[model samples]
Every structure is written in C-alpha cells, then in structure tokens.
Target: MELAIADKITQKPAIKRNVYENVTQQFNKASDLMDLDPDIRKILATTTNEIIVHFPAIMDNGRIEMFTGYRVQHNNVLGPYKGGLRYHPAVDIDEVRALATWMTWKCAIAGIPFGGAKGGIAFDPSKHSFGEMERITRRFTYALNGNIGPEYDIPAPDVNTNSQIMAWILDTYLSSVTPQERNRSIHIVTGKPIASGGSQGRDKATGQGTVFCIEQWAKDKNFDLNNATYMIQGFGNVGSWAAKLLKPFGSKLVAVEDHTGAISNPEGIDPDKLAIYVKERKGVHGYPAAEPVDHESFFKTKADIFIPAALENQITAETAPLLNVKLVAEGANGPTDIEGDGILQEKNIDLLPDILCNGGGVIVSYFEWLQNKRSESWELEEVDERLRKKVINAYKKVKNTSQEFNTDWRTGAYIVALSSIQEVYRTRGIFP
Candidate 1:
C-alpha cells in the first residue's frame, strides 16, 4: 500500500465509476495480452475470504457504537496474506476486495514472499478521541480473531493509522495468544516504532521508493532533476516525505493538495515548513507559506512530475486532461482510473504504476517482519540500499515487460505480476 501514511486525505472520488470494475479492467487487459493460464486467471479473479465483523466499542462519550470492519484475503499462494489495514469512511467490501487484489499484484511484481489482504473499518478516526481510537483499534483486532497472524496475514498501518495504532494491535493480538507463542508473534504487524520491532526505514519506505522510481525515470529520459518542478497531492507520509527527499535533488514543489484543501506557490513551497504546518493544523488548507487554491487550479499547476499520493480514482477522465505533467508517479494505490490511464497514455505522459512505485512499503514491511522473526535489527543504510536495489529491479522488469508486450506501464505491471504467479502455479500444479 503506498499509503497516505497519516490521516486519510479522502474526498468524493473524482469519478463515480466502481473502483472494482476499474481494477478488473486493468487485470483483464493484462491477462488477455499475456495469454495468462486460464485456471490461474479464474482463481486470481476472486477473493479467497471476505470477513466483515460488526463490533461494539465504547466511545469517549460513554456510549457504545457498533463499528463495521472488513478484512478481505484475496490470494495467498505466494506466501502469507500481507497488506495495510486502513481507517476510512468509504471502506466497503468491493474496495477492500480491489485493494486486496492490488496487493496480490504488488507483492508478486515486487517478488516479495507475500500474497494480498486488506482490512479496514468504515469510520473517520478524527471524530474519536485517543482513548476511543485505542478502544476501537483493540476491538477491531479482537474482532479479527485468528484471521490475522504473523505468518498467516500480517497487517500494517495505512491511512489514519500509524505505528501507535499498530502497537495497540500488536499488544491486543499478543494478549490473545499463548505465552509461549507471544515472543515469536512480534512479527504480526509492521510499521511499529523502532522500540516495537519495526524496521529502521519503514516510516519513509513508500516515499523513498517512489523517489527511487522517479530517479530511474529521470535517468532513462536523461532528464535532470535540478530545477525540475513537481506537484504533490496529499501532504501526509508519502507526499511530505517525497517532497523533502526530492528537494535535495533540486526539484521544486510548487503545489500541494490534501483533504482539507489545495495550496500552491509557483516559486516553491518548502516541504519541511508545510509538514510542520500540517502537523500543527492537520491540513494544508491554511498553511501560512502557500496560498490556497481551488482543486482545478491545483491540478492545472504545470510541473514535470505529479505525485498523486492521496486517494484512488483521483485522476479520472475529468481531471486527467487538466494535468500538465510529463510523468505521473503514483504514490497511492489506484490513484488513476482506467479513463485517466488512457488519457495519460494518449497525452504521452509516463506513468510509474502504483504496484511498481509503492513496492517500497511492503518490501520494507517484509524486512521488518524478517528482522522481528530473527530478532535481529538492520541498520538504516542497509535497509535503504536493499530497498533501492529491489525497487530499481522491479522498475526495470516493468519497463522491459511494457516494451516486450507493447502496452501501457499499468498493463505491463499487471502482466509482470500475473506472469510470476503463473510460473508458480505451473511449477506447483493444482491440488486434488
């Protein structure tokens, strides 16, 4: 999950189309082009498990509220189900299913030992107090029961979720297990704080990975990053960090948008300063340094790169044409709709698809899990190096696959994911 990595920056989707349908269209296109194995295609099209739980939690107002939560396990043939659990109002069965399927593809393309799963509760976390949030998280974890485990389905933090929430989940899960199994189960969740068995670079892994892909793109296009202009949507973990990281490369951040509002400064906006403002104000709507702008103006801001690090379906047919960018580096899952993808392709805009771009989050999550499982900690530099190598390799694979198949990068990413799984199925065969 290339998560917003903070409070979810959600709004009415840019388009009214079904997200699952969009995802399926992408999947079918790749499957058909690659001549994917029929049986595996059938198996991959549907989810293995869909768990929806209604659990009651005590609110800060001393009243109990019934919260609906869902966990969809799409496929686990590669390894355990791994994905982020989010807290958002629009989390439904279809959305979770789509996200779970994307995780399957993301993990496969990245060559990670994990399948796909996505779980989330449908509610805004901001309306609740800290105690209410904790209670809700714990209750959600308990509601999940044994569906989640260190080796079965490891959960990570997504939108409106962070290390502290993961910590609460870790504790709640451990309390339910036997004392003998507790120590070994620390790998049950990733994105925890350093003291809680998380990896060194898990916090910024997604952003770092996105930047790595951008760097690869720059190298391929012979484009210099110095004095390049970029606009980011969502001033959360992925967007904020990408800005800061790109700033050192001499890229100027001219525009930013979030759930609160969009803001822009054509000359440049200091990511560090904007981040501090967001932390203080919880949004970019009123950042002192940048002037507020309407959504149209924000998207129309011309830049070399546009990182849609917010919600999915943001770049629909309606908004796609408004973009004045040479490249779209997705730092969020399903950010571009099918129409949007077609528009970008026609516009000759290069897209580093989400599966290939956001692999950093899960790759580092894998590292965190490994570190916890072995009770060994890796240094920050080592983690960064390994992440860079894996992201670049995946980028190359996707690029070559796109060229080989003569298709869009999105389709190429799906084909790469499907091909890897196809090989595994052929080697292992079906069970009786």
Candidate 2:
C-alpha cells in the first residue's frame, strides 16, 4: 500500500545542506537504485524518536549551569539502538540525527544485530573540570531515565566523550534501577574502562578495523602498504591507533593535521613518537619531528593514502581536488560531503567509506557487551582476531556490492545496508 504520509515524510528536503541532508541524499540514491519498497524507505528514513532534554548541573564554582542534550534513535528493526555520545558545542539535533542514521547503516553493513542511535550534550567538555564533567554526565544520564537501557538504547564514546564518561553513565544508570537489575545492567553501556568490563582491544578497535579494510584493499590491488606514505587528518584515538597499528605493516606517516596544527616529515614521522607528542601537547603542533604545513599543503602533499579521521565535511569539493592520494580511508563519520564524494569519484580515488572503514569501534563494542552479559573477558589476541574477521567480511561484501552496482564504495555500502533492512521488513511485515 502506498502511504501519502510516508511519501511526504521522505520527500521533503531540508532547507539547508547539512550532515542530515548528506546522509538522506546518499540513502535516497541507494533506495532508488535498489527499487526499495516505499513503506520501508519511509520507515528507515525517519527517526524512531528524537529526545531533547535540558538539565542543570552544578559547576565547580558552585554555580548551576543549564545544558541541552539530544538522543536520536534512528531505527531498531535489526536490534537495539546503539551509537556514541559526543560532548561538543557543535552537538546539535541535525548532526545527531545524521550520525544516528549512519549508525543504522553501519551496523547493518557490519551484520551486527544493533540499530542506530546517537546522543550528545551541547557543551564543550574541555572547558569543564573533572567534577563538572562528571556532574554533567550524571545529570544527562538521569535525564535519559527510562529512555535508555541494556536491552534498548546503548551509547558509547564519541568525539569529546570517552570511557570515563561512559563509566559515569553506567554508574548513574545502574543507580536508577533495582538491586537485582544493577548487577546485570553493566551492559547498559559499552566502551567502559577495562576494569569496568570493557573489551581488551576496544581502545584500538576503530583504527585496527580501518587497517583491516586497508589490508584487504591492498591485497586486491596488489599494492604494498610497506613503506607506503600516508597522511592523517586527526591525531585522536582513531587516527593515532591506526597509525600505530599500520606502523608494523611498514606504512609511514608522512603528514598529519589536527585542530592544533599540521606537520609533515617526508622521510616519515614515527607513529609512536608522534602519538606521545600529541598526548603531551594536546595536538600535532610543536612535535619538533616534522615541519609545519598549512591546511592546503597538507592535502596537497603527495602520498599513497589519506585518512580523514577528524570531524565531518573535512574533505569538501574544494579540498578533494587537491588530494594527491590514491585511496581515502575515512576513520571519521561523514568526513566527506556529497560534493566531496563526487569530486573523489571523479578523480577515481578508491574510497573505504566511513561505514565500513570506521566500523571497528561498534564491532568491538558488541564484543564488550557480549563479554559483560556472559561474564567473560576475552584476551587481546582473541579480540583482535575476531575484529579482523568481522571487518574483512564487511569490506568484501561492500566491495562486491560496489562492483555489482558499478558504483562507488559509499553508495555500495548504503545499498548493502538498505538491502538488509528491506529484506527484514519484507519478511516480518509491518506491525498492526
């Protein structure tokens, strides 16, 4: 049955081109190509719920500050909603909606039994002290109340949020439930500290996953990663870990750019040294190992691969044309906008799309959840092996889909994800 409401809901375009629009545009393209059912398209296109809460937190100076937070549950046809919670001033509804939507596709592509959801507070965590941050996290968790649970929505770390913040959430959430539920509710959130039930290899999961995909690509292209030059856009967890893991593969980090500054070492900067430098300096600036480079020069520098592990839209149409690399492995969500994607496609740059490229975090999060639920702790070697297998499988599926559709990797990933969702909907039918 054709529903007018579904058509209207899916057809209406946003007034401005933003992250949500970018995701929707990609989704619509894949849906059209696959000839997806209209009803399912509508269901997948719209969010299941959008929760916005304003709460007060006591700051260090004894002043109460108001903070706004959002949690957008995109879909759960596959399973429970799962995603990360970011703490940044740019954490608005649109960005959260887009990220949640991507999480839906990301999980489906990875064949994980989890839907998509994302939440965030519109405050900069760097500006707050430890006590203030804890209070804010607890307050946000309290505000969520029954909206999040072990068997329902699960949030991990993203952007400014980390395992410490997740611990606060886990503790706060556990406190709200009954005694019997408290012990079993540790699975309420993933990415907690290892001492608190986090997986052994969870810290480097995202980077390792990206490396796995790259390894697969290298094999297919008969390209060698040994001594290959690469540049990274961010120096955070994902970028740093990716560089560190790739180091053993003989890949050299030639250039790096972060919020602090950009640096380049033509002979290749040592990933271990650069990582420590970033940790101490809070960014790549003043590393003393590499010469400083401007934003333009960073992208224009010659290299074999480019990893944009930073924020969204870092690679736009303007910047895409300047890239001299042969492949782009996105470690960040929505790093390339629609225009930027087009530019890369035009340039024939092989891309490991964000959904497949950066899926390791969630994949390991699944392991963490499983371990917590089963009262088991996996070793680092076991966790790494399992993650490798899962990520490589996802990469092969996406690559095959791209070949079948004669399209780019990004759209191919969406097609694979959407097809999975469509099949579920077709088999189960709609609820009354």
Candidate 3:
C-alpha cells in the first residue's frame, strides 16, 4: 500500500517515513499551517471509496490464477475521478489509495477540473502474453462496470501498463454498454490509443510536463538549460522523454538507468539513439556508445539536476545524502520519502514536487477528454503551446505559495491545492 508506506515513513521519528504517507503528512502539515478546518482536513486525508476486486484469469499455462485488483476514488469534489491504472505485482489497495489521493491534489494544483482515483492489478505484467494481459484488463474492466464512466471516473496507464491496456479497457466498456450509452460515454478513459480517441501528445505529456516545469525553474533561477548536467533514473516513458527533450537545450545527460542496468557518458549521450536502441534491444544496458555504470553509481554521479523518473522510495534517507545534485525533479509519484525530503530541504536543494512537476500528463489527458467529448482534435503546435502555459502558470503559483508560506515546494503545492479543494467543498456544501 503506497499510502500505508507513506504513513509508515512518518510513524517512527528515526525510521524513514513511507513515501505516500510522508506525502500525505506533508499536506496535513501544510493544512495545519493554513489552519484548515478539521472536518475538511479529515475528508481530504481519507479516501472516499476503495474497491478491491478478486478475479480468476486463465494464465498462459492453462492454469487459472486469482488476481487481486484495486480502485480507490480519493475524492470527486472537484470533478470526476482521474488517475492512472498500474499493472504490477507490488500493487495493493493502500498504494492505490495514496496515488488516488495524490491525483486529487495534483489535479487541483494543476487547476484541472478533475478529482483523484487510482486502480491497479496485482500481477507482474512482464510474465504475461499480450493476449493474457488484455483478458485480465477486460475482466477487471467488467468488474469495475458502472463504477467507471465518462462523467464519473477515468483511468490511464501507469507502471507496466500502456496504451494497449487502455485500449482493452475502452473496448471492454464499449462492448458492455449500449450503443447510445457508448457514443455518449467514450470519453470515460483518457489514455486510449489514437484510433480509440486518445490525444496526439498524451504519450509524452508527463515527460513534457517535467520539461516545462524544469525549464521554468531554470528561467526563474537564471540557469541555462543547455549548461545543465543530468542524471536520470528509470528509462521508462517519463525518463526517456525527459532525456530526449533536454538534448535541444544543450543538456549534458551524463547518466540513465532502468530496472535492468545503467549507462553514462560525461559528454552527454544522444537520447534519440539510446531510445531507439532501448526499443530494439530492451533496456539501457550495453548501449555501445556509452560506458556501463554500476546501478548504484548511476545516482552518485555529480550533476546539476537529479531526476528520479522511476518508482517510489528510490530516494530515501539512505540515498538522499548520497545525491550529489543541486535539484531533484521528481518525475515519478512519491519518489522521495519524508526523511529524504527533510534531508533535501535542510541541504537547501530545490525539489520540483511530483504533484506539480509531473502533472502535465494528466493535464493533457484532460485535454484529450475534452477532445473526445467534443469530437475535436488540436494540432501538435497548439497542444504544445497550451501545455507550456498551463505548466508554467502552475509552477509560478506553487513558487509564489512557497515564498508566501516560507515552505518547501511540496508543502507549498499542498497549501495551494488544499485551499482550492477547501473552497470547492465549501461552495458545493454537504449532501443529505
């Protein structure tokens, strides 16, 4: 459970707080600082609903295996539930809860008209065939049934999941619902394939969002993007995009790593070539052009910025002090634990909070939803322009809040998001 782990991160004074709980605690601390109402605070701290589903799927070996899945709707006060669906062995209810909660705040902070929800299946997708994965996803979709809809909850792809998974979800839903209902409800999911109404830029939204924020950070600090050195962890969609986008700005990408291994070139590795290589061969090991670096040494490299574009808890108390960078742009959700956060803050390191830093994907996904609902698509240039403005404005809001409250970026983001959510809740009022 991500939220449980985040909570654990804050429980023991000396022990490292769990990543998700640490994130929630940071929001709680900010709310307290803001003197937020107790009732509203409680509502924000807990999820509204959590659904766990147990379903049997026939494996590739003709054996029926039970798989557990979770879908947690953190809140819908702002709008419909919005979040990604991950397929991984480590997924659990608690993690979904935390991620969903984060989604609520992330959308609020980004000023998107959406709430927060997260769902995930508990199994390693790598071990499954494409057909098997599709079957599992369709079954999970069937279980969700009425719980997810175009106007209620929308799911995207996350960790070990992709557009194909979303395609299966859409197809399953479309087949289950009546034609009339389907026409009016196709916008339910945000990350479907292009043929299925997914937006053009959705693929690179997260990494692009990371770039927009980082570039804004650079400008505000009078730092040149071309002069910056980078060490990125995880070569997934987010990491790969960040690396590729930074090239034009003259970034000397010194290192990159995935689940398999890592590689480095102080002079900067060509992201395009590396990406193609990874696609063809899988993973970043033996890139041929760049020398292999021990996985641990990957993060230890001296650089201008360290981007943790991977999974949670990668930068904990144990690894926080080992970081040799000046800034940390969290490309993944809850990458830094509370202790690690404290270490970074004490060290005066600049951290682009995940809620704000990696929100571009969802923001664009919202655009995709709008396009789907209206049956309209925007040009890439238009989408890019709008995305830049939205991300930059959001960054400035968070930066201003940080200065106003004299707090770190994470708490500042929480303060802004909480105030917005509180106002919405107050205006909407409670139901009978």
Best by TM-score: 2
Runs of candidate 2 with Cα error greater than 4 angstroms are 1-17, 54-68, 88-90, 123-136
**Residue 215 Cα positional deviation in candidate 1, in Å, after optimal superposition:** 0.3
Cα lDDT tens digits for candidate 3, 63-110? 888888899998999899999999888787766877888888899999
Tell me the deviation in Å of residue 172 in model 1.
3.0
CA lDDT, every model vs. true structure:
0.90, 0.90, 0.86
| Model 3 RMSD, rounded to 1 decimal | 3.5
Tens-digit per-residue lDDT, 1-432, candidate 1:
332211111322545235656667788799899999888887887788989999999987789999999999989999999998999898887678778888898899898889999999999987989999999999999999999999999999877889999999999999999999999999999989999898998879999999999999999999999999999998888999899999999999999999999999989999988888889999998787888899999989999999999988999999999999999999997899988989999999999999899889899999999999999999999999999999999999999999999999999999989998899899999887
lDDT accuracy of residue 115 in candidate 3: 95
Q: After the best TM-score superposition of candidate 1, give how far the Cα of residue 23 lies from its true spot, in angstroms.
A: 1.2
Candidate 2 residue 431 Cα shift, in angstroms, is 1.5
Better of 1 and 3 by lDDT: 1
For every model shown, what is its TM-score relative to the native structure? 0.88, 0.90, 0.89
lDDT of 2 by residue, 311-372 (tens): 89989988999999999999998899999999998998999999899999899999999888
lDDT of 3 at 136: 91
Winner by lDDT between candidate 3 and candidate 2: 2
Whole-model alpha-carbon lDDT for candidate 1: 0.90
